[model samples]
Target: MPDQAERLRELVRHWELRRKQTRRTIAVASGKGGVGKTNLTVNLALALKEEGRSVTLLDADLGLANVDVVLGIPTTYTLAHVTRQEKNWQK
Candidate 1:
């Protein structure tokens, strides 16, 4: 059996390959706003980025965006821009 670390590395590699080929985007949502969903998402994103994935987090919660808050990130853009068609979904 493979060691745990090796298995994780292989998993992440496979994930990154798929992410790159598919150019995937995912959302995390919940009816309960304060349930730490954003925190978990941001942590996973940062972990992937730290492991060398080029990641972008979109706070798609309309009026209640929170990924930036949990990740301590400040952005110059928002879903408002997208709603207004001011920007396409690119980084």
Candidate 2:
């Protein structure tokens, strides 16, 4: 169990290092609903992609998930699946 914990820590550290090496990160957040946070995030991702930038938009709105709907993309899995160990992020 100690070895597994160490491995997980190492993996987290590696990802943190990689994130630090990235060029930019954009986080769209809102304290209230009825705002265009999802739309803005989607549009920003699209604009960044159009400019030839690699963009990974994580729809973390667990309560009201609609980013996939707005983008017309269907998702078979979500963070819940990953948390429940039903799906792997690599997949």
Q: What is the C-alpha RMSD of each candidate to the true structure, in Å?
A: 6.7, 11.8
Q: Which regions of candidate 2 are displaced past 4 Å?
A: 1-23
Q: Residue 62 in model 1: shift from native, Å? A: 1.1
CA-lDDT, candidates in order: 0.81, 0.85
What lDDT would candidate 1 get against the real structure? 0.81
22-91: candidate 2 lDDT, tens digit per residue: 8886888889996999889999999989977788888877778888899898988887888899998776
29-71 per-residue lDDT for model 1 (tens digits): 7888788887888888989899877788777887888767766
Q: Distance from true position, residue 59, model 1, in Å?
A: 0.7
